[model samples]
Target: MNAPAGISTLDRVKIFSEITIKTFDILVIGGGIMGAGIALDAASRGLRVLLVEKQDFAAGTSSRSTKLIHGGLRYLKNFELGLVRTVARERKVLNRNAPHLVMPEPMLIPILKNASYGYWATKAGLTLYDLLGNVETPERHRMLDKTQTLAQEPLLNPEKLQGAGCFVEYRTDDGRLTMEVLKTAHTFGATCLNYCELRHFTYNEEKRITGAALQDKLTGKNYQIKATCVINATGPWSAKIMQQDQPEKLPELVHTKGVHLVVPFEKFPLKQAVYFDIPGGRMLFAIPRQGVTYFGTTDTPFTGNLEKPRVEKEDVAYLLAEVNKMFTGLDLKPGDVISSWAGVRVLLYEAGKKPSEISRKDEIFISASGLITVAGGKLTGYRKLAEQVVNKALEKYFPENRQPSGTAKIKLSGGDFENAAAVKGFLKSCQEIGQLHKYPSESLAYLVRNYGTNTKAVLKEACRLKAENLDPETRLLQAEICYTIQNEGVTSLSDFLIRRTGKLYFERGQIIAILPAVKAAFQKILTLGNGILANQESEFMEQFEAAVAFKNESKNAMVSA
Candidate 1:
């Protein structure tokens, strides 16, 4: 889709110019889901907002989540009814507003004879879960007998199985969701610049924050952005940014690491999503998306570098062991892992509690310098968190100009369809367009689902590339690349593969197969010199090799053991 007028384009020079000249009403530091949601919320309420990210949007913990817009069912086990209700309600709102990105997914929690929670207890929990979330009757929780549970997912282990609790959750494309929110905010006149780092804050006589000094990572150029209120929504890095204001205060964040492993569908073949408790009393999810099944998330306290969190050998081993035990006659080895990702969850520090015991609730802190900092929130609760943060900033800075948030009702970019039926109609229309372009039906459906109303724009770009003498598949990928670069502010090949398309997790082999064609298209469209292209290629290769090596090393270690 063509960028709305006055919205900054992907060009760094133009964005820098706008940031230098304009004094925004709200400056958001960080472009993850929190910052993106805050920008959208504030901008939709008529605030002149500017969002700056040190890296690509969702390049951090936002993209590394379990990819579920789920109510915290496990939190119920902790007696945190309030968190569950809030997340469940927010999940409904997200599914309603961004149907294209968040889709209903049925999940099964298998009950075993030796399970921590007995059958009746499990049923009661799910019943309360459904009621609290106001789940529709058709999608409400149901108790399935052992035979029925196995039928729903035949691969599940039958040994010592009692039954299963089935309920509906929503799955999402985390990175795409963040981008769409920012895009919608842009449509409402929010200026967002990725690859821009907030170096320092500008202060007034009374030490009130007036603006920020930013440095563009790509161009190495500095720019100043003045705003009436500056918000620090930097997720795991929130403490570091807060320290810039007051070095004497102790850090309030305790970061925990979560890791996920992806395996091909043919290898795992999970028919439905499964939430199972392991021997350690921690829960894990095995969810199917596209042609692969991904299971995650080992939560352990982490003190390592946050930016480059890799799946450690122990993390992969624990997941593989649990998955193998949960499945029937299937012994999953380390080699089964195609790709892995690790992310840090910035949680509020609670003394005398384990990492998993720390609350996921967000906290807002205001420094004496008038810098508003928000930290430690879940992805599902991002919109509500943003609303609260924006409201606080407005109340503190613009008390006379406070506006009610309209973000809960406003559709995200590419999410303007009237309903799910409308989305289906859009997909059907795209299939018809695909017929005219000789595009595959399945590929066209993928595009429509991923791009929503913007499928037409992507198809237009594909049609324009038909004369390039590329293969059908390459043409489709080239079209997406072009659309991403032109529209999504994708500056690097990694951003396109990892975040924009999710090929890194779901289609790792396909990415390797199409790398050459993708690189060629990138060079042609970006007009990058060979030196710059080489550097980008080197970086991509390093990441690709690291992922491959992680898997290979695990397999080798297992074999040696």
Candidate 2:
């Protein structure tokens, strides 16, 4: 089948018009990782699918993850062997399919004298972890003595460091992964819309759900979309959507907030990804990427705004304290943080469990109104969650032509390479294009890593705009902006900066420097007026500042006094 048309503003308007006029086989609410996976799965099965997101794809928990595609080795501590195995197997599948995006990174688990897990206990756990997850012998756990561990990553605290566990874990760009899945779903003929809000559900005489009332956040125009099946994969907002259907039902989600802080490599200089425990036995990661080290994830109960979860001063203090304790040589402080992000996890409401203790296992709820809702899943398990959700939908609504999920065998968008070697060869070839276009080797390699097989398309666009006489960096940025606006449904600058490319997290300086050029390019291509451009810029800056800000007025005043 032919690939679907690129997702521009015009394409979005076209899709809105089409979905408004016809009934679809499935209407998927929320365009995060899980929803994107569901859309792809259903569409690959020959079902007409429509997916809508209130914001840009992966603008929530999906984008704000710890960015690991690992087997959830930590879950084994709680005796969740099944989840560990499932995520480990899925990690292999993701690495096989999206080699350019999913990469194997060596993780170091420091064994301190006062560490929660002793040397032998940690080894036993890791051994069981490897066995249950079917880890290859070569890629399995390795016991690193204190000298070897410190040699690998010299920043570790050596005062009481007994040894470490070195193992392989898959790292990924979560937002880009979600986008590729959504794009692949579109390729398979699923119509998807970002920046589209769901107003309410439409029900038939028996009160069974039949359709959705959606409003385009950009155009402020409303449209009604009819569908035979509607799946609610709204992540943290699943409770809100379910409440709209059954107001009497108690809320089923416990919102746990996780935050990450990014520090330049010069300050921390972590050579490998380290998963170390804090004072309270909770684990956090400090992974190095693009000349920076980022670590996170405090699991506190969140009662704040879901749309804009800001990193608080306490959150930063907690992370910095943990990092300093583990890496004693690094005297890191809140001031060292250049950027940060907070995300809310919509975990199942298990009575009497702490926030971190809640299970990451996904659960699906089918309301009496025929509204199918899925909640409480990790990013690593999105495909299986989607497969399960679609299977149930098919059994209930389309039993006559039931089909199993094809996603496992098929590669995601831009992930058609046969193996990791093929990906390396492709990247090596891309360097020639970079040389021809005067693009830096590093920038081109970054694009290849992020876009995979689609790197050529972006390069072609960059070549087409070579006459613009842009700087090497600006040219690369322009090419990405052009590709995103023309093909990736980037309705706003924040979408392009934060989700499409992770400039907000990794390339903050570049984003600020090229903001004007990017804005002009979007305006010229999408015909966005000055007012819209200004609003988008303001919103992007506000979000950028909120993510990085660490000082609270009240706290600062008390400290000073």
Candidate 3:
């Protein structure tokens, strides 16, 4: 890999070698959003950091989110002003600092008979939500009468519809945002490794936490790493990590399973995001995204293994039944679904409360043995939570030294994308160039959006390789797949399709069908032998098939049986 233009790869072999010599200021476990943010914070502030992910970044709860960067307007219904304000403020920071990915959007909260929140209450909450965000962005809330509301969202259930309140917020590609965070952390020199398993830990004689043992999933090689401080951001696996050090250091982790079902854009094609309550009091979101629509999610408590979660028949039936009620024409059956996925959210150890009622507010715990654990927050506020945790680590490490602050203002890799006119001028110049003129003009717009300021490198790389006969599965190019392997740390087809590109999440069928070509591209650039490539492809296809089988099995399985 050529380091992906501006981003840097940590060279896991080198990081592990030094760590085996018991060298590192910090050891970070679970490289999801929280850990990634903390690693960037610590690295930028001059702490030698190593972050290990048991799987790929954002492969778990982070990717399974509703994919919104908005403040929790629902929390305002419960009068949780502090949490609402906290997340709302974060929305502003992310929008400005990561503008290429995060953007403003309006949400429609349809009011109806026997709704949990009536029109009056919803309006009050939206007003407070706007106040909390403090107008960092132009979009805000507006009240819509029945006819006007129905016009705004034609698919919405208008039968006795008391009207709607439109409020502004943010949405993003969750996986992309997570990757950008990790990439930015790498830019600041945080050593990161995916598919690295934490075997155990090392402790000082005085019972201070020292380091850990890690196994590389690629080569199955094991290594030991020592650190002055250890932070666990393992999400659902937090309990597993803690019990490795002390049997009773922390309580057991509670797992909550959520499922998202993707459908065709024509099915709903909502103009704005909708937050409608299902029967009883639970709420489900119908969000329009990237030429498709998805509705979810059931927050059912689970005791199943966290390694993999299977979407149950009851969850699908419940979601469909609920949405069908709000929208009479939906009538969405199992076959209408394009794709579905289930993920487990690790809730804090609790006695009797249901997972749905569990708070999304994050908690930080420092044990007697000096291990820090962060758990239970949404995607919008991960960076803020990390800012708090890193401040603690720095005060403990440097005592009197100063550290750089203001991560909220720090621009991410592609956030500095030039203004629209500059982009248009560049495109005009590219059109005039003889070498670039032959490239597909239609794809120029999509290329600019996906690659951001890095389009220059991709186009330049395309010119350099001059690999003709490009075979792209969807919007992405086969050459771009090669570039991803040669530059981005894409080891498997899954990483490239699902994370590096949105093909899997957006068009999973093409990903399953084009495995051979994707692997061929991988082989061409990485020079991977057939045996290694074959094994990887087979497992990915099996996983994909298993996912399909899971969906079919749910359709056949009984909800109560």
lDDT of all predictions? 0.86, 0.87, 0.73
Best by lDDT: 2
lDDT of 3 by residue, 69-127 (tens): 97877666556688888999898788776665777778888988776778888888778
Candidates 1 and 3: which is better by lDDT? 1
lDDT of 1 by residue, 267-374 (tens): 988999999887755899999888889999888998888778878888888888999988986687777778888889999889988887777888899888888999
Candidate numbers sorted by TM-score from highest down: 2, 1, 3
lDDT of 2 by residue, 241-273 (tens): 988888787456889899999999999888899
160: Cα error in model 3, Å: 3.7
Candidate with better TM-score, 1 vs 3: 1
TM-score of 3: 0.91
Residue-pair clashes per prediction, in order, are 0, 0, 0
Error of 2 at 489 (Å): 0.4
Question: When superposed on Cα atoms, how far off is each prediction in RMSD?
Answer: 1.8, 1.5, 3.1
Clashing pairs in 2: none
Task: Record all residue pairs in model 1 with backbone atoms less than 3 Å apart, i.e. clashing.
Answer: none
Which residue pairs in candidate 3 collide?
Answer: none
